[model samples]
Target: MLILAATPIGQAADASRRLAEVLASADVVAAEDTRRLKRLAAELGVEVGGRIVSYFEGNEERRTPELAAMLVEGQTVVLVTDAGMPSVSDPGYRLVVAAIEADVAVTAIPGPSAVLTALAVSGLPVDRFCFEGFLPRKSGERMRALTELVAERRTMVFFESPHRTEVSLRAMAEVLGEDRSAAVCRELTKTYEEVARGGLGELVEWAAGQEQGVRGEVTIVVGGAPSDSRTYAPEDLRELVAARQSDGLSRKDAIEQVAGETGTRRKDVYDAAHS
Candidate 1:
């Protein structure tokens, strides 16, 4: 059997009783960070009687098969990460997949997750939400990813490095609109936990002004665009077309502008204006 366990995100007392019990008696423990695992075990007063093995990003490939073999032998194999749940932007996904393929019983010890923690406190509408783990570090790739999500109607959640928070917010403002509502959660479940809520453009400005810089884990939540209103008047479309036309724009440019501003088809705008 393979047990993917969840560790505390920040507060030690948040560790569940079942997690401690399994850690104490499992036949083998696969940890992302052995040092942190040992500390957690000590804090919980659970003496790990089983062997502990390191299974992080680098060794996950090699360790998955070995761990699956142990599970096939009917030994209880427990997998844990440094924080939050296993396989959540962390190790244990590969092992779980391998265990499933090998016909081994695989389960999870659900516990603390930064994604949910921040989302819950964000004050933004969370009835419908999507988790976008982390944006690509490269500026171009990150912009491309955000462009695809521009029409996402559900509130979006994302994890970001403190150093890049400003840059990410700037890109989000550009793609998702400057006035879009968003929240930035920092150091969640800890004493210094903070949640900053404002427009994406406001956050970009705030981040730029911060000389001290941000620290600890961060989760950003942006509210979805409103879905109720869709009507546009003919007068509004005419005004848009006339403004673009007055800017020395071509007939094609005026029609395109009217279409984009009024959410009407370009052909309809062209036909209406020509007629």
Candidate 2:
């Protein structure tokens, strides 16, 4: 049997009752971070009677079969990450696949997740939303990715590193429009947690003023393009492209993003920009 448990994102009290019981008496426990798992066990005041193993991204592929074998032999396996539920942009997915293929029963001990935590607090409409785990690191790749979402109707959520929060926000502002609404959620569910909401451009300046770089975990939630954006004309797209170009995006990227948002063909926007 395989049980995926969600750990408290930051608040220990958030740990579910089923999670504590499974942690106290599983045959084996696999965690993304062994040290964090130990700390969680200590905080919960539960004795982990089972063997503990490291099952993070680096070794999950190699260790999946070994863990699966244990499950095949009727051992109950508890999978956890440093925070949140297993396989929610975490590394427990491979092990889950292995368990399923080996004819083992798999279940979850659901608990806290930063994704839903951020979404719930964000002022943006949450009725429809999508999670984009992480954007590409390079500026160009990041811009390209944001451009693709310029016209997405559903509110979007993204995970970004503290060091690059400013960069990512700036890219989003340029591609999505400076007036686009967004929220920067930092250190969710923990002490000093914050949710900064405003126009994307305002958030960029806010991120820039962070003297010590945005600290702790970050989740960015940006409201989607307006419904009327799809009816924009070529002249309107040219003006939009010029705005992003003024914001330091390359001319090519500006055209690409403008075209995406306005539903205009790239070549059409290109011709409009030249004219």
Candidate 3:
């Protein structure tokens, strides 16, 4: 059997009872960080009865099959990352796939997750939402990704490093609109946890005001565009068209491309541009 366990995103107290039980007795334990796993076990005061080995991004490729082979031999192989559920912008996905292909039974011990925790506190509509993991680090690539999501009506969640949270918020303000609602959650469930909720512009200002750079694990939740609102502002459309034009497209072609990209009719975009 293959068991995927969720570790604490913040407080060790958040670790599930089931996770502790599995940790205490699994035949083999593959951890993202062996040292962290040991620390967590010590906190639980339970000696892990399993064969402990590292299973992080750097070693998963080689280690996944090793663990999968254990499963094939009928050993209970428990997979865990440093925090949260496995395969959640974390490692463990590749092993899961390997298990499925090998006809191995796979299950999970669900517990604390930063994505849902952030979304629930974001003050945004949660009926519909999507997890976008992490955004590109480069300014241009990040902007392009934001532009692609400009029309998405589902609340979007992204994992960000503390240092890049402000930059992400600023880019969101430009592409998604300054007035768009958003929340930045830091070190959730931890002693110094913080959540800032407001419009993108306001959040950007708040991030800038952080005496020290934003710290800890960061999760950003941005409200979706209104269903009836134009996906792109007039300025956004114009800039997009201008970009296309600079790339050798005629004005008409640029408008057409921009309209298609924004899900607006070419006639409507043409009228908006000329208005």
Candidate 4:
């Protein structure tokens, strides 16, 4: 059997009862960070009666097969990460896949998660939302990814490193528009947990001007585009009008073309053209 356990994101007491029992009795415990695992075990007052092994990003490829083998041999393998549920932008995905392939029964001991913690506190509408785990570290790649999400209608959540928080928010401001509403959740469920909410532009400025760099994990939530009026600029409308005109469209046809292409009023495009 393979057990994927979720530890608390912050408060030690948030540890689930099953998590404590699993930690205490598994035949083998695989942790992303052994030190943190030890600390968690200590917090729960559970003495691990299992062989502890490292199963982080560096060793996942190699360790996964070995761990799966243990499960095949009928050893209960417990997998844990630094925070949240395993296999969610964490290190247990490969091992879980291997276990499933080898016909080993797998289950989870669910606990706290930063993604849900941040979303719950975020002031944005959460009736519908999507999780975009992490953006590409490189600025160009990150911006490109954000561009594709401009028309996304569901609130989006993302996890980011503290050091790159400001940069990532700024890129989002550029692609999603400065006025797009968002929240930046820091150290969620922890003592220093902070939720900063505002337009993307404001958050970018605040993050950039902070004298002391941010610390700990960050989850960012950006509100979706408005259900009506897709926020197309006059310049964008004009560009569409010109493109259609070049495609042999008459002035009336071009106006309709631009309106249909951009979901803007034909009169708005005409005013933009003459102004």
TM-score of each model, paired residue for residue = 0.83, 0.87, 0.87, 0.85
Q: What is the Cα-based lDDT of residue 258 in candidate 4?
A: 56
The count of backbone overlaps in candidate 3 is 0
Residue 50 in model 1: lDDT: 95
Residue 52 error, candidate 3, Å: 0.6
lDDT per residue as tens, model 3, 32-133 = 999999999999887999799999989879988898888999999998898899999998899999999999999999999999999888788999999999
Task: Give one digit per residue, the lDDT tens place, for model 2 in 161-261.
Answer: 99999999999998898999999999998999999999999999999999898999999999987887346666787788899899898899888877777
Query: What is model 2's C-alpha RMSD?
Result: 3.5
Q: State the number of backbone clashes in model 4.
A: 0
Model 2 compared with the native: what TM-score?
0.87
Ranking by TM-score: 3, 2, 4, 1
TM-score of decoy 3: 0.87
Alpha-carbon lDDT, every model: 0.87, 0.90, 0.89, 0.87
Best by lDDT: 2
Of candidates 3 and 2, the better by lDDT: 2
Consecutive 10-residue window with the lowest summed lDDT within model 3: 252-261
Number of backbone-clashing residue pairs for each candidate, in the order shown: 0, 0, 0, 0
Residue 78 C-alpha lDDT in model 1: 94
Candidate 3 residues lying further than 4 Å off, grouped into runs, are 229-261, 265-275
Q: What overall lDDT, based on C-alpha atoms, would model 3 receive against the true structure?
A: 0.89
Per-residue lDDT over 138-230 for candidate 4, one digit per residue giving the tens place of the 0 to 100 score = 876785577567667799999999999999998888768889999999888899988899999999988987789867889999998777767
- How close to the true structure is residue 120 of candidate 3, measured as C-alpha lDDT? 89
